[model samples]
Target: MKKKLLTVAIGSAVALTIAGCNSSSNSTDTDTNKLLPKDATIAFAGVKAPVTDAEKRAILASDATITTGSDSMPLDLEYNVFARSGDTFDHAVFGQLVDKQGNPLSKEDGSPSIANSNEFTSLLPRGERLFSVSQFESRPGAMFLMELNQNTENGELSVKDAWQIDQSGVNGGWVHCAGSVTPWSTHLASEEYEPNARSLVTGADAAADRYAAGFLDYFNGDESQWNPYQVGWNIEVDVQADSGAAPTATSKKHYAMGRLAFELSYVMPDEKTVYMTDDGTNVGLYMFVADKAGDLSAGTLYAMKWNQTASTGVGAADLDWIDLGHATSAELSDYIEGANQLAFTDIFATADANEDNSCPDGFTSINAGGNGQECLQVKPGMEKAASRMETRRYAAMMGATTELRKEEGITFDPTRSKLYLAMSEVARGFESFKKNGADSSSYDLGGPNHIQLEGFNRCGAVYQLDVASDATIGSSYVAKNMSALVAGVPATDSYGDGVQNPIVANSADYADNNKCHIDGISNPDNVTYMSGWDILIIGEDTGSGHQNDVIWAYDFGTQALTRIQTTPYGSETTSPYWYPNINGWGYLTSVVQHPYGESDSDKDTGNGENRAYTGYVGPFPAKAE
Candidate 1:
C-alpha cells in the first residue's frame, strides 16, 4: 500500500543563476530575475502577523464556519489489515461520503457506504484486527479522515472500543514504511517508508505519478534486496491498537529511530522524539527524546547542523558544528547502545538532498509512488529499514554523522516541544530555495507533479522547528516569502493520468488540511498545506493520482487550513466520492498522530476580541445518530 512522493522543484520562468556559494552580504546580488533572500524576507514569518486592528476586522467579518462542534465527534472503530501473498489475505475495508465541496457525496441519492469490513484472516494476538466504525456515515463538522490502507486496521485508525492498547504491538506482513502518531492516545500502527536510490543522480521517473498506485513486486530480491540500510524507523506493533490493525510477521525493531532510509516518527507533548531524515541521501533534522515513553523509557538522538554560510550573503554566521573534537550530546546517546549499528550509518553524514555531506552521488527524489513501481524495486537491503539481519545487530549504538544531509519531512512541534523540518530541497533560502543558476552540484527544481502544490514555483518548503533548542525557522520574512511549496500536483486531475509533475502524481498529504500538526508542527503549528484548503485530503489511485482515491475538506481561517466541511460523500462519472477502499482504506504506508491535541492556533478569545476559531472553514453536514 505504498506510494507518496513529495518534492519541491521551483524553476518557472527559467533564466536564473545563483547556487555558486553566495558568501552572504545578506545575499550578494548577482540578479538572475531576482528572488534570492532578496528582502522578500526569506518569504514569510507570520505572512503578515500584524492582524491586531481588532483581529483585522474579525478576519474581515467571520463565517468561515467557526466550530468546536457541529456535532459528531464520537468514533469507535477498529479496522485492521495484514497478510500479503496468499492464504485468506483479502484486505478491504471501505467507506466514503463527502460533501462541503471536496465533494464525493457517494451518489447524493442519500450518499452511502456507511460502514464496512472484509473479514480478516488472522495476523495473531497483535499482528492486526479491530473494527467498529462510529455508526459510519460522516459530516457533522466533517473530517472522517485517513484515506489509504492495505491491511486497514492501524492504517485506517478510527476506534473507540472504549479504548484498548496492549502495550503497543507488531508482528508484520506488509505495513513496510512509515509510522508514528501518539502524543498520548496511540496510533503507531506499523512501520514502512520504502525508497532507496543512494546515488541515482536524478533521472526522476517514479512511474508516471498518480501517486504511483501501490507498487507491487512481491519481494524476492535483486536491486540490493530492496533496502534496510540500518537507521530503522521502528516497528513493534499489536497493542490492542484502536486501529483494527494489520501487518506483522514478527516485528520487533526499535533501537530509538536511526538507520538511514527509515521513515515515520513524531511525538512531543513531551513524549520527546523527532525523526525522518530518510537518507539514501538527505540528512539534517534527526532527534530523539522519550523522557518516558510507554516503552523506550529514555532517549537520545540528535543531528541538525547548519551554519557557516556567509559567502557574501551578509547574515548567517551563528552556525555550529565541527565539534567532533570531543563528541558530546551525552556521548552520542551512549554510542548507539553498543554499536551493532543496524542503520543510520553516519548518523547524519548522510550524503545529500542538501543535508550536506556534500552529496556527489546521493540526492533525493525518493519513491513509494506508482503503486510502488510494480511492487517496489529501488532496493539496497530493503532500502535500509534498520539493515535487517534480524534488525542489524540490534542497533542502539549512539553517535554517527555525515553532518546532516538532504533531510525530508520529519515532524514534531505540537508541543512535544518543537521540530518540523521538511526539505527534499533547501539551501538558498527565500526567493524559494535560491536558484538562479546553482553549482555546488546543482539543485534548482521548479514546479509540478512530484512536489505537491498550492502556489509559487511549485513551492517546496515546510521548515519550522524549535524542539526547544534545536530551533530553526529564524531566517525571517516568514521564511523568505513562503507562499511556495504547493504541487501536491493535481493542478487538475480531470480523471486518471492527467500528469502534471506526476512522480506518482501526488497524494501523501502534508496535512489533509484537517490542520494536522497533531502537534508535529513542521512550521508553525503544522503549517497545513493549502491549495483547495483541506477539510480532509489524501489522494491516490493512479500516478499523478485521480481515480476516486479520495479524502477532502476545505476553508478555515485565523491560521487557515480551509475545507469548510463534508458528509454523505457521493460520486458518479466523478467528483462526489465517499472512500471505502475495502474494510476502511487501501494500500497505505504512513499517517501518525496519536494521543492528539498539541495545538498552536485555535485562535479563540473573548475578553478583548479575537474569537476567530482559528479561521473556521465550515460546511459540516452528514449525520447518522
Candidate 2:
C-alpha cells in the first residue's frame, strides 16, 4: 500500500499533504488547507438510477421487508477495517439489540429495542485494536454498543454473532445526538434532551427547579431520592477490548460538564479540552477543560459568547469564554437539596452580579461568593440549582450568548486549530435572545444557519471557529467564528422546476410535488473530518427540500462539495463518520435512521427491503506512499 500525497494550491505553490495519515500517538495530521488536489474539480450530478442487485442485497437481506428502498455503500465508498475484522463473515451489517443467540433482544414489553421512529441518531465506531460500534438510541433513548467478530475465510461481516454490550435499563440513557470516540479510547455519548419533568412531581413541598419534579417522580415522589442528578449529561463508556462484554462495562456520567440538550462531544488532541454544543432553539456553545488528560470526571465548563460584528451571519467575530464555575456530582446533589429546601429567590438573586451596568434589567445572577475564580454571572433570577442542573438556563444567566437553533454536530481540525459546528437551520428572522423577544435584536449571520439570499443557498450551514492555542487554564479563552456558509443552491431561475430548493407546503403534497432539489445537501446534521485527507463529511437529517437525505464530502482546499450517498425518502442520513486507513481502507460508516415508518414491518414483501440499515462503505483510495 502506497501513501497518497495530495497537492494543494498554497500561495502560488503546491503544498503536499498525505491522506490516511495516522501517527504513533493515535492522533492525525489532517490539514484541511493542504489536503485537496490543486486541480480538483467539482463532480457533476447524475440520476440515482436503480442500484444493482448485489448492492441492494448487501443492504436489505432476505429477512427484511416493508421498505420502499435502501441505500448503503454507494460506489464512492467501501467497508472499513472495523467491518472486515468482525467475528462473522457474512459481510452483513447489523442494527441495535441483537442477543448472543443471534436474535433481536426483546424488552420486558416483549418488543424489540425501542427504535426512534422519527428522530435523529448518531453512530460512531472506535477502538485501539478491536472495533466497538456505538449508536444513540434516540427514543426511549439509550446508547447501544456492539463488538464486531473477527472475520474468517469465506465469512463476511455480519451481526449474527454480535452481542448487545449495554443493557437498556443500565446507566440511564435518553435521546442522544452525534458523539465522539476520545483519544483515550473512551466512548462519549451525549443525551440530546428530555423535557423538564420536574413539574410533574406531585408533592406538598416540591421545589421550583426545572428538574426537581422529574427527579422526585423518578423516585415515585420520594424527595429523599431526588437523583435528578441523572440524565442529560455526557456518559462515558469504557469500550476497551476485555470490557466490551455486557453487564461488565463500567460507565460514568460527567456531571461537571454542564447538562443541556447535548449534541456532540469533541475531545481535543490534548485529551483534556472538549468542545460540545446544545441542540435546540436559542442554545449556547460550550467547552470543558478537564483537570487532567484521559479523565473527564471533573472539569471547568465555559460558555461561548459571540459578538456580532456584521449583518451577514458568516465571517469572523470576536469570541470569549465565560467561566460558569465547576461542581462535582456530589456538590450538584447538595445544591439540589438546598434549592428544594429554601425559596428559589433566596438561592438566586434577581439583581446583577457584575456592576459593569451592561446587564439587562430582567437578567439574574447569584453572588460570586468569592469562589477565587472569575465566574460569569448568569441571567436575572436564575437559580444555581438550575445552572448546574438546567445548564442552558444557567448559560443564559451568565450572559452567555443564546438563540442558537438546533446546534448539532461538532468536529475539530487540530492541524488548523479550528472547530466546525452545524446549525441545522436558521429560520427567517431568528434571534438568540429568547427573553423579551419582541424587543430583542435579530442579526442574520451568513452560512447554512441564515435566510437564503438571491444566489445564496438556504438550508442549514457550518461555522468555523478559531480556537486560541495557549488558552490559559481556568481563564476565559477567546475564539471567533472566522467564516460561516449558508447552504442551498444559488437562487437560479430553475428553482421553480424543483431542481433545487423545492416547495411542498406539507407532507400531504409530498407525493405529487415530491421532486426535491438535491443538488445541494440541505439541513445538514452530523459532521466529521477525515484527517490527513481533509475531507469533511456532512450528513443530512432533512425530510424536506430533499426527502431522501444525502451525505456530502467537501474538499476544504478545492472547495468542491460532492454528494456521495443518498438515503431512502423520509429517512435521515445520520452519523456519517470517516476514518483514515482502517484495515487498510479509508472507510465511512452511516446509519439510515427509520427510513420508512413503523408500519413497515418484517413481513414477506417479496422485494426484501427494510426501513433501516447500518451502512459500511470504505477502503477508499488511501494515500500512495
- Estimate the TM-score of every prediction: 0.25, 0.67
- Scanning candidate 1 in windows of ten residues, the lowest lDDT window is 566-575
* Model 1 TM-score (2 dp): 0.25
Cα lDDT of model 1 by residue, 157-192, tens digit? 222222111111211122233334454423342233
TM-score: which candidate is best?
2
Q: Which candidate is the best by lDDT?
A: 2
Off by over 4 Å in 1: 1-129, 132-231, 234-251, 254-258, 261-625
List, residue by residue over 1-625, the lDDT tens digit for candidate 2. Answer: 1111111111011111223322222213333332223232222232231133222222211110011123221222222222211113232223333332234445568754434322232222344234554554443243434544323221123332333444333334556666777886667877776444333233433445543333232233445533333567787777544444432345676777877778878788888888888887556788888888888867777877766555443223567677787666555544434454432333343443355533345544321111111223333444445556666656655667664566788887765777778777654224332121223223222111222222222366777778776446542223555357435442223433223334433344333323333456566788888776666778777644554566777777677676666554345667776555433334466666654432223321433233355544443433322
Query: How much does each candidate deviate from the true structure in C-alpha RMSD?
Result: 25.1, 11.5
lDDT (Cα, 0-100) at 51 in candidate 1: 20
For candidate 2, what is the lDDT?
0.49
